[model samples]
Target: MKYYNKLLLLACLSGALGACADDEIAAFKTDKPESIVEYEYLNAYDALKTYVDRTANPHFKLGTGVTESDFLSKGLVYSLVCANYDEVTAGNAMKYSSVVGNNGSMNFSTVRDLVKVAKGAGITIYGHTLCWHSQQNNKYLNGIIADKVVESEHPSEPTLDPSVISNGDFEDGTITGWGGWGNSSSRAISAAGQGHNGGHALKITNPTVGSDHYFVQTSYNVAFKSGETYQLSFYVKGASTGTGQVVAQDANYAGDPFLDKSANKDFAITTDWKLVEMKATVTADRTLILLNTGKYEGDLYIDDISLCHVNTGGGGGIVTNEYAVQSDFENGLDNWGGWGNSSTREVVDGGGYNGTKGFKVVNPTATNSWSAQVAYDFASELVAGETYYLKLKIKGSVAGNIGAGFQKKSDYSGRGDFPAMSVTTGWKEILTSVTVSGENADRFLFNVGAYAGTLWMDDIEIYREVKGNTIPLTPEEKADTLTYALENWIKGMMEATEGYVKVWDVVNEPMSDWPDPTQLKSDPNHTDTENFYWQDYLGKDYARVAIKLARKYGGDNQVLFINDYGLEGSGNAKCKGLINMIAYWESDGVTRIDGIGTQMHVTYSLDPVKQQANEAAVISMLELLAHTGKLIKISELDMGIADVSGTNIKTIAVTLEQHKMMAEYYKFIVKKYFEIIPAAQRYGITHWSPADSPDNQNSFWRKGEPIGLWNLDYNRKPAYAGFAEGLSGK
Candidate 1:
C-alpha cells in the first residue's frame, strides 16, 4: 500500500509539472518549502496554555490596539449570549441570554438578578438578540413589516353588536350560538385568527367578551401523560362578519389553559384564518383537549389538528422564520442632462417606472454644441410639506459643466431652461434638495450638453423623507457622520453638499521614496511636487476639519472624503501604506476617509490579463471598506493614450469596442453592487472626461489616438454610441 501511494503521488506530481512548462516548473520547485514538521496533539485546556506561553512575549498582541499580555492578565473574557425569554432556562446560562414574554406583562426580575451576578463577576453582557423568530410581540411585528396598504372602495360592515359578548360566558366551557367568525366585518376574526371585537380573540356582539363567539371542543381517544412531548395542530376559519381567536387547551382545567400547567403558542389571525400547528413539551397532562375560544358570537370551524409524542429522535428538524425584504430605491437615482447648440437628448430606458427606457444625450456639434431639454413626470406626486431628495447619473462630454434643477412649469418659458441649483463635471451623481410650494408638480425638466459637450444620464429618482416617531437627530446620530467619512467619498460629498463641506481630500497621490509616514506634507519648491495646491492650502486637518464642519451643518450628512489613487497592485504598496495613515486620522475623529478614489487609468498598452486582475483587486478592497456601510463611487475613469493608438480606422474600431466593453462592465458592477452591498452604501459612478476630446488627448485626440466618444470638434464618436447602447440595457 505504501509503494502504491508513492506511485500515485509521483503521477500526480508529474501531471502538475506538465501543466506548467519547464521554466515555470523549475521556478515552482525552487520556491517550494524544504522542511516539514509535525507537533504532538494537545487537549483544549493544554492547547490553550501552550498558546498563552508562546504568545506571552511583550511584543505579541492579540487584538487591535491592545497587546496579548494585556489580555492574558484580564483572564478569559466572557461573551454575552441571549435568547427569547420563552427559550431561556437553567439549560442555557449564557450571561447575555434574554427571556421574552408579554410586552407589558413580562417578568424580568429573575433574569435581572442573573445578569447582576454576572456583571459582579466581570462577565460581559449582551442580550440574546432583542428580536428573533419566536419571541417578537404583535406590536413589533406590525411595525417592522408595515407597508402602505391600499383600502378598498367599500369595507364590509358588521351586523352583530359587540356589546352582546361577555368573558363570563366562556369560563364554563359552554359553546355559544354566536354566528360571527369567518364573517365580513372588522368585528369578525381577520385572516390572522386574532379575536377582532376584543379580549385578544375575535369577539361577536361584544368585542371585549371571550364567550359570545362560537367555541369548539374536541376529545382525543388517547390518555394524557406527564413529562412527555406532543405536537398539536388545528385548522380554523372565521366568519367574514367578525374576528375571533382559536385556542387549544385542557377542557378539564379552569384557570388560564396555557398558564404554568400547559404550553401553547399564540398566532395572530386576520380575515383569512387558516390551519396552524404547534409542538409543545407536556409538562403535566390531562386528557388532551382543544378549544376555539373567542367572543365573536359566530360559528367557529375547526379542522385537521392532532397531538403526538415529542419524538425527540425524529427528523422534524427546527422551524425557521424568514425576514422581510428591503427596497431597492431607498437612496434614489439621479440622471442629469443639459441642452446645448446641436446637442440632442432622449430617454433610453425608463428603469421600470413607466416601463420605457432611461435617458441619454448625444453631442452633434463640431466645437461644443447643446441638446434639447428632456424630463420625466413622476407617477406619484411629492407631498408639499415634506422634504425630498433628487439624484441623477451624469457622464460628461469632454470637460464641461453638467447642471441639474427642479422647477415648476411656471419657472420655464415652455421652451427655455429652469434655474439650476447645483452642477458638476465628469461622470458623477449630483444630489440636491427640492422643496415644493403652493401646488404639487410631478414634471421635472433636464437639459444635457447645455454648452458644448456630450453627456448621458440615467436612473433618476426623487425620494421622500423616511417617516417615523424617532427623534430627528442626536449626538449618537451625529457621530455616525464620522463613521460615514471612513467609508465612501460620495457619501461625504453628499453630506457636505447638503450643508457645509466638512471633510476634504487635501492632497492625493504624493510622490515619495519608500513608504513615508508623512506623505501628506507640503513642499512648495519640491521639483517632483504633484498638485501642491491642496497640500499648501488645506493642512493635514483639511480633510478632517472639512468632515467636522460638514457634520456640524449637514445634519445627518456630515463626513468628508480624501480620495487618491495607486491602490491596485504590488507596485502600489506605498498607496496602501498611505491609506493606513488616513486610518490614523479616522481614529482621531479628524480627516476620515469617506472613500478611497482609485483613479482607474487603463493604458492601451496595459496587459489585458493584468488589467483584469487589478480591477478585481480594486473591487475587492472597495468591498472590504463597503462592509462598513459607507458610500463608494468610481471617482474618475479614463483610458490612457497607449490604450487607443493605431491606424485611424483600426484605432476608432478598437476604441469603440473598448468603450462598449467598459459600459457593459459598468452595468455588471452596478448590478453586483446592489446584490452584495446594502442600497444605503452605494454612491455613484462618474466618467472623468467627455467622450473623445482634448481633455482625454491620450485616447480622444493627439495624433492617431481616439479614446472617448466625441472628437475635438465635439462630434459623436463610436464610443458615445457604445455608451448609449449600454445605458439602454439598464
Candidate 2:
C-alpha cells in the first residue's frame, strides 16, 4: 500500500526479493483523476506579453508592478518582467514618500539606477505619483507650517512685574491651560511637597528624543502685544541631566516662527532648582510660551513660572488693535458673500493662492467692474475721518484690475471705491489706507466683474492701525511659503526622471469616498507621521497645481494621469465621484488632464451571487470609463480568491477549482477592458501581482494570497493561459 511495497514488488519480479503479492501490484495501478487534466492546456501558451496584438493597438502597453531592487539587480525578477511586460512601474521607489526624507531632503539614487536599468533593457518607466495625502514626509511638511518659534534673548535678571500668564506658580494644584505635544509627552501637577520650592511643580515626562527639539513641548497661552518685550522666568530641572529651551510664538500659527537667539537658547537641566529667565519681544496680540525638551529624555519639573510685560518709559508703546474683519478660511467661510455677472464665488481648501483655504471667484466675461463682487458686512459702521488699513493678497488666471470699495448696506449709500489694482497670475499684496468720510459705510466689497477669469484672494484684513511693530507672518505669507515647498519638491522629482520618464500619475487618489464623494481627501489632524495631505494645506486645487507643474517640468510630450482605486465597486460611487472631481479640476479649461487610471485590485468571489455582481461591476466600470472618452488604464490589476464568507483564500488553502475560477475572473476583467474601452482610449493593463504572494502575515498587499498568474516557483499558472486568451480575444 505504501511506496516501499510497490518497489518490493518490482524488485521481486527482478529477483531482488523472496516473494511478492498480486494485491500489492494491483494497489499501484490506480487511475489518475480527470479534473486535473484540464489544467495541462495552460502549457500551450507562450510568454504573457506575446499574445498582445500590438499592430491593432500599438499604444497598448503591457505593464507590471516590480520591485526596484529586483529589476536593478538584473536577477530572476528582472528576466521575468522584461520577458513578459513592456513597461514597469516601481511599486514604491518612485513615490514621494520614498524619495523625500523627514528632514525635507530628497535622494534619487535608486530612481536613477532603476531608470538606467529599465532603459537599457528597452522597458519604459511610468512615474507612480506626484501628489497624494498618504505616504508623505509629514514631519518635514508639518514642521514647515508649525507654530512659529521666535526666540527672545535670555534675560539677565528676573522681572519684578506681575505675571501675565495664569497660574504660573502651580499653586492651584491644577494643570489647567497647560499642555504637552509630541514624543508622547504627558504633563501633571506634582505632589504638593514635590515642588522646587516646597510647593506643587508642573511635571512633564518625555519618553524619547524626537526629530526636532520642539517635538516635545509644554506650552501656556497668554495675550501679548507686538513690539512689547516680555520677561519669562521659571525654576526647573530634570530627573536626569538633559537640555531644554523656552521661546515665545504668536498665536496666529500659519507660518514659521522667527528665531532671535539659537545658540544661547538652550539650558542644561539637572536634579536641582535653577532659575531660567528670558526676554522676548511680542509680535501678535496673542502668544504661546513654550518650554521645549524634545531632544531630551526624562522627566522635567518646573515651579514658580513667571511671564511679565516689560513696561518701557516711552509713552508710545506698541498698540495692538484686533482686526475689524479677518477671514483666513482656515476654520471656514467667515460669512463672505458674492453673486453677479455670471460669476460664482466659494471658499475652497488648499485652493488658496498659496497652500491654505482662500476665496475663489470665477467670472464668465468682462463687464462692469462691479458686476461680480464679494462682500463682507461689518457689524458696526466705520467712524468718519478714521483711517482703516486694508490688506489682502490676490491673484488671477489672467491679468486684470479688480475694484475695492466700501458702502453702506441700508440704501447703498456712502459708496467709496479704492483705486483699481492690477492683478496678475502671481500673487500680489494690496495694502491701502482709506479714510472713512461717508455717513455710514458698513460693508467692504471686492468688485471683480471686469476680470474675465478666475481670481483667488487670501488673508483679508481690515483694521485701524494705531501703531507699527513687527507681527507674525499672516496666513497669506505662510501659504506662499508652503506653496514654494510643494513646487520645489515636484520640480526636483520631474528633473530626476526627465530623460526617460514621460508619463506620470500627476495626482494619485485625491478624492475621498466617505461623507462626500466629490470632495478631496484631507486629514486635518495629520496624526500619522507618514501621512501629509497636501490638500489640507494647499486647498482643492492641489491636483491642478501638480498637473501644471508636471507639464512645465516634464514638457508637452508627457502624458499625465489621475489615478485611484475602487473604481469598480458595486454602486459605481467612487467612479462617479472621480469623474465629477475631474470635471471640477478641469473647469479652468487650461489645466488639461491627459488620462484616468483605475486600479483594479480585484477579488474572485466564490459565492455565486457575489461573483455575478462583481462581474457586473467590472463591466459597469469599463463602460463608465469609456464614456469619458479619455485614455483609461488598468493601472494595478491583481486577483485573489475570496471564500464564501468573504475572507481571502490563502495560497495553500486554494484548491484547483478555486484557481480556475480566479483565472476565469482575470480573463473576464481583461476581456471586458478591451471590449468596453475603444482602441483610442485603451491605455493598457498592468499586473500588480505577477507571482503568488508568499505566506507572510505582515505583507502590505494581498498577504499570503494566490493573486498572481504564476506560482512563486516561476511556474506558469492557469491564470496565465486565461490572461493570454483574453489578450488574443479568444
Candidate 3:
C-alpha cells in the first residue's frame, strides 16, 4: 500500500495522470516514520533567561561579561546577550586603567557610549571595578607619591664653557653640533622640553651592541691647543643600564685610529640622568670629542655638552646668565620638592602647555596657599640686591590661582613674591622679575595647594634668581592623598555613568595568596609597572574609603560588591580572609557593604577523587557566603574540563563524554547557587565566558579551554541544556 501510494504521487507529478483522479490522490497517504534526536535537541530550548523562575528568585539577575566593542556594534554577540542575559558587565571598558589616562585625565566617552547602548537594549550594567592593583595608571600614581627632590643648598658651579658648544642643549630643535653613525645607530634631536634644561636633547638609538663602544659615536668638533687642560661635561641617561665613554679623537676620524691621541674616559649610564665631566690635556690641535656608546643596546640621550679651556688663572670662564634651577621634568622630579595637604605631584610627559613634558600637581581641594607646596632650593642664597628673572609655562585643568615666591630655606620666611598668577586651560607663559630684599632667602616656592584641579608647569627657570632642594610622604599623609585620589576617580566614573550602573565591584582581588593569603598585596620592589596597590598606600581602610566614595557618588540605589577569584579553593582561606577583612572594614558601623562575590573559575576533573574534592570545595564556599547574611554572587563563573592525566583539556581536545561532564558540572554549580543562598540575598550569577575560549595564546582568560556552554561556532553544547535545567530547577 505504501509503494502504491508513492507510485501514484510520482505518476501524477510526471503528468501521467490517466489513471489518477482527485479522489484517488486524496487516498494516496502513507504513515510517517518516528524522528531521531541527538545533540540538536539542545537548540529547541528558548533563550537561557526564559528558564529562570522569577517568582522563586525575584531578585536574581542573569548576567554575562562582554567586550564593549562587540556589544556596541549591535551584532550577533549583542543580540545573543540581550536575548539571554538581563545584565552585562564590561570586560575592560569600565576599568580604572581604561578610563583614566596617563596624565590623570578622565575620558568617559567610551563608558558613556556603552551605557547608552546597554540602556537601549534594556540591559543593566554592573560596573566591573572602581579600584584594582593591576591595569592602573601606575606612572601617574607613582609619580605623585615619588620621593621629593631638594636641590643641594650649594649646587656645583657651572663647568660647561657656555660659548664653546653651539646648540649643545639642542635648543635649535636639531642635532646641529653633534654627528654619529654605526652599529645600526641613528640620531635625532628629541622633542621640545625633552632636554635636561627645558629645551631639547640629542637622542641616539643603537640597535646592536657592537664589540667597541666607538661603534656608535656622537662627535663634536672643537679647536683645542696641545698641553692645555680642558673640561668636557654633558648630562646623559640611557633607556637601560649601558656603558659608554668620551674619547678625544683626531680631526681625521675617517682614518684608522691610533693610541696616545685618545683619552678613554668611560661612564656607567643608568636610567637616571647624570652629569658626566672629563678633564684632560689635549694632544691634538683639532680635537673631536666623541661620545662612544655603541655597546648600549637601547636609546641614549645627551644634553648640555660643554667643552671649556681651563685657564690656570683659576676659572673655566664667566657663565653669565647661568640658571640656578632649570627644570623641564624630562629627568622626572629632580631638584623639585613638595609636601603638605593631600595633593599629589608627578612629572608627566606630553602633558605640558606646549605638548612637551611638565610637572603635574593634582590638588584634591583648595586650602591655605602653603598647604600643598612645590619648592626648589637655590644653589646659594639669592643676591640681596640682584634682580632675578623667573619664567614658566603654566596651565590648569580648570581656572585657578597659585602663588610663587623666594623664601628663606631655614624657616620658609618670605623673601619676595612674584606677581600672583591665575592659570587657565590654555598654556600661558608667566614672566616676572623679583629683587631679593632679604639676605637669607635660599629657596623658590610655589603654593599650589590653593588650586583644586590639575596643574602643569613647564620650562620653570630662575635665571640668576638662584644661588640654588623624596620627602617620602608620611604614612598618614599618604593615606589622605590616596583617599582623595580614590574619591575623585569614583566621583568622575559615577557621574559619567549617570546612575544607570546600579552595581559595582568596588574593589577587585584585594587579597594576595602568597606570604600570607590573608594580607593585602604589597610589592615593595614594584615588579609590575602597571600595578599600583592602593591598600599598600592607604592601609586596610582602602576598601572602606572606596565604599564610602561609591555610595557618595553612585547614589543610594547602588549595589556594591567586593569581587575576587580563587574564593572556592585553597580551603576557602581567601574567602575567609575576605569576610574577616570585610568585618574589619565595617567595624566603624558607618560603612555598609552590600555583598560579596566569588569568582568560580572551575574545572571538571576526569579523576573521581579530584572531582569529589572540587564539588566539596564549591559546597563549602557557598556555605561560607551564606553565613555572611550578605548577597552572594558567582561573579565570574566558567568551567574547563581536565583529562585523566589532570591536564586542562583545550576546546579542540574535548571529547563528547568530557563535554557532557562539563555540562553536568555547570548544572551542579548553578543548582547549588540557588539551593544554598536565601532568595532575598541572591545577587545572581554571571557567565564570564559565554563561548569556548579561542585557541590563541594571547587570550587573557583560560585561553584555548573549553570553558563555555556554547561552542566557538555558537552551536549549543550539552552544557547549555545543563545550565538551562539548573536555572529552571529541574
Candidate 4:
C-alpha cells in the first residue's frame, strides 16, 4: 500500500505540460541553421531539458521501498504475521460433511454455501483432501472397476463366420477350429485365467445356425467370513438370448456340479444390459464362486459388483452439539467480594469490584462518617502545576448530597482537602474531578459521608490529567460531573502528548460480577451491595457510552482503548463476552480500540519456581491479547510475600534479585514486542504506578517484601534503576 495522493500527481503533470511550440518542422528537411534544426528536433531538445532538470534537483525520484526505520517512524511493527482461520477451525459451522451418501449420490451445496459465507468474511478456505482410504471404501471403486471388466469381456468372445457353423462342430477338438479356429480357443483360454497362460480356460460348446453358438463359462472366487451376509449386484448383457446359471462355491469345479442348493442360481439374459442382484449368507468361511452355466451363449458381459455391511451403527456425534458456560456470581462467598467491606474493594475473580470489606457509609448525621482510602499513596505528590482526576464508583442509597475529595499534605506538616465533585442520590454513578492548589499536595483522602445517605465506592482511580484547567469547585458549582472529567482527560492527554499516546483505555471493567438484581432480592445467597454499582450509574451502556465519549474527545489522532484486568482469552467467558461487546463498539463506527491492559498483581510468591511460572502464565495471557492485533500492556505489576518477617536476609536478597530478574523480563518483553508486533502498531509499555512501597501497618506488607521501586524516603530503589537501565537497553 503506497500512500499516493492521486490529485497531487495530476497537478504536477498539468504544470509540466503547460508550454508548447506552435511551429511545425517539415519532414526530412534540414533547417537553414544547424543549431535551429537541432533545437527543432524533439528528442534532442527533450534530452537537453532532462539533463538540466537532473542537474538542478537530484532528489526527484520515483518508486522506492519503505525502510524499517521509516515504518517505525510511522509506528508500524511489521514482524507479527496476521492470523488465518478456515471454516473448520472457526468452529461456527453447523455441519462438517457435505455429502451424506444417503441415496447414493454426492451433493456439495452445503459446503458451497459455507465457503461463500467464509469468503464474505475475508476468511480463507481450505480444501480438504481429494482422496482418503479410510473415508472412501471399495463400494465407490467397485462401480468403476466393473465397467472396465465388462468392456474387456465383450471383445474377446467367440464369433463365427456363417460358413464355419455349417461346415464344422465348434465343440470338436478338431477342424483347425474355425480359422484353424482352435487357435481362437487357445487365445480365449489365455485371456480368461488369472495370468496369460493356457490354464483354467473358458470352454465353448455347440454350433447351430441362427441359434446361440456356444456357452461360455468363467468363474471368480472371493473370500468371505463365516456368518456374514454379502449382497452382490452387477449389470449383465448378451449378444443373443442366453440362459445363465450364476454359481457360488468355495473352489473351481471342472466336471462336478455345485452341491449346495443355495450356492447356485439361474437367470435369463436378454440382448440389452440389465442389473442383477444376488444376496448370500455364509454359514462358514468360504470363497465366492461365480459360474455361468448356460448351454447357448453368444457373449455375456458383467459389471458393477458391490458389497457392504448390513447392520452398521448410526453415524456418531451430531455436529450441532454446542457447549457454553455462563456465570453470575450468586453463590456464597463467591470470588467477587461483597460490597461494604474494606478488603473487598479489590477486584476478585468475579467481574465486579469487591466493596463489602471496605467501609460502608450510610445515612450518617455528620459530613464525614464513612471515609476509607487505600493504604498506599500516589506514585508522586500532586503539585499545583499538575491536574488529576478522581474516578470512583458510587451508588446512592438515598437521594442526598454526595461529596468525594482527595487530600494532600500541605507544608509537610498536615493534610488539606479539595472537593472533586458532588452528586445527588438517583441510584447513579458520579465521577468527580478535583484539582490540587498550593504546593506539595500528593497524598489522597476520600470522603463520602456528607449529608448522609448510604453510598458504595469501588475502584477509586486517581490519575494525573495530562491537560485541562482544574477550576475550584465551590458549594454553588454545577458541572458535567465525572463524565466531564473523563472527556477532559482524553482531550488533555491528546493535546499534551501531541498524539504520542495513541492508545487510551476509555473505561475499565464496567460489568458487575455480582448476582442479578431480580435473583438477589429473593435469594439469601445474594448480597445487596454486590449489585450496587451496576444498579446505579452504569446500567447496561456504561462501557459503550464511556467508549463513545472517549473517542469523541480523542479525535482522529488517538486510538481509543477499552481495558479490563481479567478477561485474557476465549477461555474466560466474561472476557469473551467483553470482547463481543468491544466488537459491537467497533461495528458502531468506532475503530479506535487499539489495545487491552491486563493487571498482573502478584501478592504471594507461592514458591520461587511457581512464582516464575505464574509470571510466565500472565505473560502468555497477555500474549493472547496481543494476538488480537492489539497492543498489550501489563497495566499493574506488583508482587508481595505473605511472611516477610520470617524471611531471612538471604531470602530478601533472593526476592529482590527475583524482582530484578522480572525487570529484565519486562525489558525482554519490550524487545519481543518489537520482534513480534508490527512497527506501526507497537505501543510503548507503561507500569501501573511508579512505586510499590508497602504500608508498615499492613500484615501483607511486612517482612521487608520489597514491592515497589522506591523506598518510603522517596529515594529510587534497585528495581527502579534496573527498570530504567532495562528500558535504555543497558
Using lDDT as the measure, the top candidate is 3
Candidate 3 deviates by what RMSD? 24.2
Instruction: Supply candidate 2's per-residue lDDT for 538.
Output: 71
The candidate, 3 or 4, that scores higher on lDDT is: 3
**Prediction-by-prediction clash tally:** 116, 8, 13, 36
Please give each candidate's TM-score.
Answer: 0.26, 0.55, 0.54, 0.28
Task: Pick the winner on TM-score between candidates 2 and 4.
Answer: 2
User: In model 4, which range of ten residues has the least summed lDDT?
Assistant: 77-86
Prediction 1 global C-alpha lDDT? 0.38
User: What lDDT does candidate 2 reach at residue 89?
Assistant: 91
lDDT of 2 at 557: 80
Worst 10 residues of 3 by lDDT: 1-10
Error of 4 at 60 (Å): 32
Instruction: List model 4 lDDT by residue over 74-171, tens digit each.
Output: 22211110111111211111111224243234444444454444345443322221111113323432222221111121222221111101111111
lDDT of 1 by residue, 49-125 (tens): 12212222222111111111222233321110111001111212211112223232333454445445444543322
lDDT of 2 at 71: 84
Q: Which candidate leads the pack in TM-score?
A: 2
lDDT of every model, 2 decimals: 0.38, 0.77, 0.79, 0.38
Q: For residue 461, what is the lDDT in candidate 4?
A: 52
Predicted candidate 3 versus true structure: per-residue lDDT over 195-312, tens digit per residue? 7856578899998789988888877776666666677777988888877877666767632222222444567788988887777676656567777888889888888776766644
